[model samples]
Target: MPTIRKKGEGQYHVQIRKRGYPTQTKTFTKEVDAKRWATIIESEMERGVFVSRTEAEATLVKDVLQRFASEVLPTKRSEQSDKSRIKTLIEEFGNYRLASLNSTQIAKFRDQRLKVVGPQSVIHEINLLNRVLKTASMDWGIALPGGLPTEQVRKPIKPRGRDRRVAELEIAKILEATESLELRTIVTLAVETGMRRNEIASLVWDEIDLKNQTAHLPKTKTDVPRTVPLSRAAVKALNAFGVKEDGRVFALQAESMSQAFERACEPHRANIVGARFHDLRHEATSRLFEKGLNVMEVAAITGHKTLDMLKRYTHLRAEDLAKKIG
Candidate 1:
C-alpha cells in the first residue's frame, strides 16, 4: 500500500511499498516534490529495483573502518602509520554516525583539535574524516543524516610552507654535535637517504640488503616503499653504527632522534627560515640534480609519485641551470 498524508505546515509524507521489497518513505514540502518522488519510485519499482538508505545510515563507524582495515591497510606500505591514523579516527569519531556528521560540528571539532595538536595535524584529521564520509556516501550509497559542508568548518591557515635544507657547513656542525656513533648513523642516513626521521628510525634490519646495495624503506611519510641506493657515505655510516642483534635500527624513539637533530641545529634556528628535519629531503633532491642526475632518477630515489611533488623538492641552483643551457 502507498500512503500519502499531510505533515506539518507545507510538508507531505509519502510511503511507497510493494511485495518482496522494503518500504521507501520520504517527506516533501511541496506537492511537486511528492509527485516527483512518487513518479521515480513507481518507475524504479516497475523496473524491479531496490536500495536501502536507512539500513546504511544505521551502520556504525567501526563497521565503516572495515573498509580501511580490509581494503586500505594491507596495501599500505607503512602498517604502523595506518594503525596510528585509524586509532585516532576510532578514538575521536568512532561513536558518531557517518550520515549524521555536519560541517558545524566538524568546524568545532577542528578548532578544538587544533588546540591539542598543530593546525597541520587538525587539517589532516579533518581530511581523514572527510575520506570516511566520502566512502560511506559514494561507495555505500548512504544518505547523509546531517551532511557536512567541510569548507565552512576549516580553520584559517597558520602559515605553513617550509622548504628547509641543511647548509653544507651547518650540516658539519650537526654531525659534530651528535658524537654518539649511533647518532652519527642516524644523521648520516638521514642526509643521504633523505628519509624522514620517523621512517629512518622505523627501519628494521631485515629490510636492508647490503650485497644488493639497496635498503628497503618500507615505512615512509607517503606510506609507500622506497628503495634507497646505499651511497658509500650512507653505507660507511651504517656499518659504523654496527648491527643491533635485534631487528630494529635505532634504540631511541623517532621523536628522540628528531629532538637530537633539532638540538644540533639550535644555533641556526634564529634565522632557519622554516627549517625542519624533513627538509633534508628537499636538500637531498636538490643536491642530486646539482650533481647531474636527471629528474627520472631523482624520482626513483625519492619515491615521489608525481613530477609535481618532485618539483617541490627540486631546487636547482642558478649555476646548475646555466650549465644545462650553456
Candidate 2:
C-alpha cells in the first residue's frame, strides 16, 4: 500500500513499500505531480523496469564522462574544447532519465540549443551526444533508443571567404605595424604558409625540420597530417626569433592574434578589400596560379583535400581574371 499525506503548500508526501524494492518516500510540490510519479513507479514496478535514482545516477555520470576522458582528452584537440562541449550537453540534457531521453526529446533539445549557441555548434554538440547515447544503447544497454540527429539540422552559414591578396603596399603597412618580433613572425608565417590559427598556435619545435625545409604537422584542423614546405619568407620570418631550440614559436592567444591581425590591417582594409586572415590561403593559392603552377601543384601547396575544397578559396575578381586573359 502507498500512503499520501497533505504536507502544506498544496504539496504531498509519498510513501510506497514493496518486498523486492525498498520503501521509498519523497516530498513533491503538487499532489497531481506526486500522483503522476506514483503511477509511473507502480507501472514500472509491475513490469520489473523500475530503476532507483541512487542506482542509476552513477551510471549516467560515468557514461557521459568516459567519452571525454578516454576518446576526447587523449586526442590533440584544443584544451578547452572537450570540456566545453561536454558541459553544454550535461547542462541541457543531464537531469532526464537516460532511458527516457528519446528522438522527440532530442529534437526539442536540438531546437533549444540552436537558439542560444551557433547552429554549427549545436550540430557539433548533438553529434557528440549521439556518440554517448549510441554507446549507452548498444554497449551498456542504458536505454537511449536511436541515433540523435535522425535528420540533418541546418548549420549557420559562415560568410563567403574574403580571399583578397594583401597588395605589396598594404603588406608593407602591416609589416610596419607588426612591431613585436613575435607578431611579425606569426603574420609572416600566416601569409607565407597559409596555416590556420589553431595549427599555428599548437605548433611545436619537434614538428619542424629546418634541415629538410619542411614542417611535419602532426595534427591539423582536417585531422590529416601534412608536411608544409618551408617558404623562403617563412624561413626569414623564423630567423627573427633567432637560435630557436624548442617550445611554441608563437604563444600568442588565438583570439588575440585574430584581433591584432584585424587591427594591423585596419589602415589598409580598403586596399586589401574585405579579406580576413584566412583569406590568405586563397591569396596564397592565387599567387601559385599566377606563378604558372598547375591545379595539382596548387593543391599540394594549400593542403586542400579535393578540387571542390580548393575552389572555395579561389574567388577571382573579374578584373584579375581579365588581366590574366589579356
Candidate 3:
C-alpha cells in the first residue's frame, strides 16, 4: 500500500499512491515516524476524507503575507495601518511554514508581544494574523491540517476605555490659546458635531447642507455613510468662513490638526490634563445624551455601530445629572 526507503543517514522517505488520490510523499528522520505518517495518510484516503496539504506545507508565512500585502491590504480602508502590521508579522513569522504554525507558537507570540506593546496592540496584531490565515485557507485553497492556530490562542484582555471629557473652561482656554482661526473652527466643529478629527479635517463644502442643517459624510472610519445633524453653533462656525460650492473645508490635514491641537493645549496642560482632540467627540456625545437624545438617535448621528462603543464616548457629569434630577 505504501513504499518506504532509506535515503541517507537518518533519512527515511515514504510515498503513498492511491488509485483515486494524488501521490503523497514525505521524508522523516526515523523509519518509525515515516511509517506512522504513511499509515495516517492511507487511513484518511480509505475514509474518503483526505485533503492534500502539500501546498500549505511548502508555502512560507512570509510569502503569504507578501501576497496579502500586495493584493488585499490595498483594498482595505485601513490600508496604511494594515501594511505596518503585516510588515511586523512578516518579520516575526516569515521563516515558519504555514502548516507548522500552531496554537503553541501563536500563544508564545501573544505573550512575547504583550511584553513590548499594550494588550490592545497585541490584539490587533493577532486579529490581523488570523485574517491573513483565513484568507490563505478560504480564498487561496490552502488546507491547514492543524486548522487556524489563532482560533485556539487566548487573546489578551482589552484595556478599559478612556473617559476623558473637556470642560467648558478648558475648551475656552484651548480656543483662546490657538491664534489660528482654522484650528479654532475645527475644534468647535469637533465638540459640536461629535465628528472625528479625520472626518472634520477631510470635510468639503459640498458635503455640508446649511439649509438642511446637516453634514453628509460619505466616507467614515466605519466605512458607513452618515448625515450629522448640525447645531446652530456648528453652522455659525462654518459661516465664519465664506462658503464655496466644493473644496476642502479646512486646509489642515488630520495629523497637522492633531499636532496643532497639542501645541495649543501645551501651555494649559495643568488645566487640560489628559485631554486629546478625540475627547471633543466624547464631549459632543455626552452633550447629545444630556439633550435627551435616545441611544438610537445618538448612534445615528455619531456612526457608532454598537451601544457599548457609544457608551465609551459618552461621559455625563454628575453635577449636570444632579441638576436634571432636581
Candidate 4:
C-alpha cells in the first residue's frame, strides 16, 4: 500500500513500502504526480524489478567522488593519479545529483572540458567518471539512469606514443648539470634500468640485492612486483653511491626531480626543446635492444607488463640501427 499526505503549499509527499524492498519516499508538487510514481514503484516492487535509488538520488557527484577516494583509491597503486582525476570530476560536476545526470549534460561537460585541457587529459577525466559510475551501479546498489554518460560521448583520440630518445651528448650535459649527486644517480638509474621516475623515487635499500645484481620492486605502476636485473653500470652507480641501511634509495620526490631535471636541461633548451626526462627510459629500452636483447628479455628488465607497452619505449634511431646493419 502507498500512503500520500498533503504538505503545505500544494505539495504532496508520497511514501511507499513493500515487503522485501526498502522504503522509498519522494515529494512532488502535485498529488497526481505522487500517485503515479507510487503506482509505478509499487508495481516494480511486486514484479521484483525494483532497485533502490534512494542513495543514488540523494547522493551528489561530489559525495560519491569523496567516497571513492576514501574507500577505493587507497588500495590502488595509481591512487594519486586517480585522486587527481576524481578531484577534477568533482570540481566540474559536484552539485549534480547522481540520479539526475544524463548523457546530454555529461556530453556538454565534455565539450567544455575539451576547450580548456588537451584531449588526453579530458579523456583521463572521463575514464575516471565512468569507473565511478560503474562501481556505483555494480557495488553500491545505486540506480543511475542510462548508464555511464561517457559511453554516449565521442571520446578523444588516443595520443600517439612518444618516441623521444635522449642523445648521448645531451645525456652527458644533463649528468654534468644536475645539482645534486642523488639527482645524477637517479637519472643514471632511469637510463640504465629503464625505471619510471616514481619507481626510482620510491625504491628502498631492501629492494636492492647488489650481490645478485637485481632490484626487487614490490610495487610498480602496473600493480605488479618485478625484479629488475641491474646493469653493470646500474650496479656500479649503486656501489659508488653507497647503500642506505633501509630507506628509499634516493630521498627524491618525483615532481621535484622533474623540476630539477627541467632546470638542468634549460641550458640546452633549444637543442632538446621537446625532450622529457621520461625519454631516458625510451633511450634505455632502445639501448637494450641495440645490445641484442630479445623483446621478452628487454620486457623483463623494463617491467613493461606486455610487449606492446615495451614497444612504445623502444624507438631506436635510424642512424643507430644503420650502424648495426653495416
lDDT to native, each model:
0.72, 0.68, 0.90, 0.84
Q: What C-alpha lDDT, on a 0 to 100 scale, does residue 262 get in candidate 4?
A: 83
Model 3 alpha-carbon drift over 4 Å, by segment: 6-11, 18-21, 46-49, 268-271, 323-326
**How much does candidate 2 score in TM-score?**
0.67
TM-score of 1: 0.70
* Candidates by lDDT, descending order: 3, 4, 1, 2
Give a tens-digit lDDT track for model 4, residues 167-230: 8888888878766788778888999899988889889998899989999888888888889988
Model 3, range 192-255, lDDT digits (tens) per residue? Answer: 9999988898799989999999999988888899999999988998888667889999999988
Candidate 2 regions off by >4 Å? 1-62, 65-71, 76-79, 134-144, 147-166, 266-276, 289-301, 304-309, 324-326
1 or 4: which has the higher lDDT?
4
**Model 4, stretches more than 4 Å misplaced?**
1-26, 31-50, 268-272, 306-308, 319-326
Model 3: which residue pairs collide?
A: none
lDDT of 2 at 264: 72
**What is the C-alpha lDDT profile of model 1 across 166-273, one tens digit per residue?**
787767766776656777788778778767677787888888876676788866777777888878888888777786545888887887876766766665542333
Candidate 1, residue 234: lDDT: 88
Pairs clashing within candidate 2? none
TM-score for every candidate vs. truth?
A: 0.70, 0.67, 0.92, 0.83
